[model samples]
Target: MVDTTLEGLSAVGDTTTGFDHPGLLYHDRDDYLGGARAFARAAVAAGGPVLVAVPGSNLAALRDALSDLGDAVHYADMAVAGRNPGRIIPGVLLAFAAAHPGRRVSIIGEPVWPGRTAMEYPACGQHEALINAVFAGRDAAILCPYDAALLDQDRIDDVWRTHPWMIGADGRRPSPWFAGAFAAADRFNRPLPPVPSAAATLPYVVIAELSRVRAFTAGQARSAGLTVDQTEDLIVAVNELAENTIRHTPAGGTVSFWTEPGHLVCQVDDAGHLVNPLAGRIPPAVTSEGGRGLLLVNQLCDLVRIHTRPTGTTIRMHMTLTP
Candidate 1:
């Protein structure tokens, strides 16, 4: 007999069924834990692999509850792997999903935990919405757990707009408030804040100009009081995105660098629309080719944002000059 907790584990059923890439969870401890286990238990029963990507404490919580069965589910501390919501797709979800092709996998991801800062929150919100665009179809069920008690009403409310499924202890239901999730994410896509007036700017329109771009960025970063480590990171990030612009756009783009109180900011803009929000966030696999630039930038920088539309794409990378 099926466990009652397994009820509504997958609102869209198995891999073949059409379902949203993300299912939003507005839950307290009990409901969250229950839903997590239910999905795992159900996946195991169906002979599918299960990955539980949450904070360390929650991993322990689910592991203790599942016991030997818990050993069956792979675990990663989402707090670390998903520190940047942009990274969760390639680092966690897609990595696990790619491991077992032609079969469905279950993933429990908690990217919007309570401790996430306000500056980071918008990207998290956009991350949740972009999940649909990244994994619109295929064989994976990604369950995003949100703590209702910890999150504000608006954050909770956004879940409805981003995810197609609403999971609770009682059962799963279609999100009545589900709007165009991608569009909603776009709404949260605020422009990259202005670079300080005192900062430096470098403009380029060709591949041949990349060296100059890097030299200027490195020099400006140092002038802004960045340490050697911070300066190096900014240089690498600026170089990569500048390279991406050359490869992706015909008209090339411009690179701008500046510094704030405790942070350094560099932005690259080009006439290219990056529809995939998860682009640089995901790590490339052994078999993968050429998408590691943005991922590298995310690792080197403290925070990153990409604003893309029909007109063009602007990728902003932020680094904390101090440890």
Candidate 2:
């Protein structure tokens, strides 16, 4: 058994006093996934329940890989469940931690991509806040798997600094309070596949022009092997975003559709400046009316990015398309 001792614990990022873990921090996805699989084995062998909260996009693979784990695991779609930890990460952590009485619970996170950086959208700021909030005062370890392409390492380390018993990717064992969580770090140091690219673009663009955002998205959906119901969902998501460009802009905008490895992307670029940061998406509480368009966009797409400057706001919305 991997011993849990501060002397064995290695720190990666800056360390703080209040609430942080001291464990390994991995930059590679393969390493992270491998670590997760190893930790799961250890957790199950120890005879405790494993709670996994994954992004909607990652559900299929995660389930397939861990399916044999049986009833020992309970799964949830964190985004669909509206369990956003960034906004209220602390509360989310507390609630989950309380739900599992004595059994060790592992928190798994796979948030949206192109996350807000200090330079871009500040809204993505709470990654660590969510982790700290959930693990605060609790003994459970946390595993945060984010898209490194989108988030900066500086910001990630800033969040890692908060946990006292945490382990980064450097093979350190933090305080035992953070040991299980650190063990999570230790288990994740493996290999990953190369980043997958999108499919061809020529035929994809031709289809988008021939149809409205609705039809275009629908056609692509079918071609991408999506179910009829799934096609409808993708259509609704794309239509709203496409319509936003046509309706809210001065002249008009261009909508281009394409397919990546696991996502169907709809990009709308208009001549209008998005003076307001909160232009498109709205919260769910005000669902009495029809203003929750972008809000739906946020929930439906695996990733959503809006680049607005003096030029215009380029909305890149990605929907997961898988078999």
Candidate topping TM-score? 1
TM-score of each: 0.80, 0.45
lDDT of candidate 2 at residue 299, scale 0 to 100: 55
Q: Over 4 Å off in model 1, which ranges?
A: 1-27, 220-233, 246-252, 259-262, 270-300, 310-312, 320-322
Q: Per-residue CA lDDT of candidate 1, range 33-90, in tens?
A: 6666666677777777778888878888987776667456888888778776777776
Error of 1 at 82 (Å): 1.5
**lDDT of every model, 2 decimals:** 0.74, 0.51
TM-score of 2: 0.45
- Model 2 residue 245 CA deviation (Å) reads 2.6
lDDT of 1: 0.74
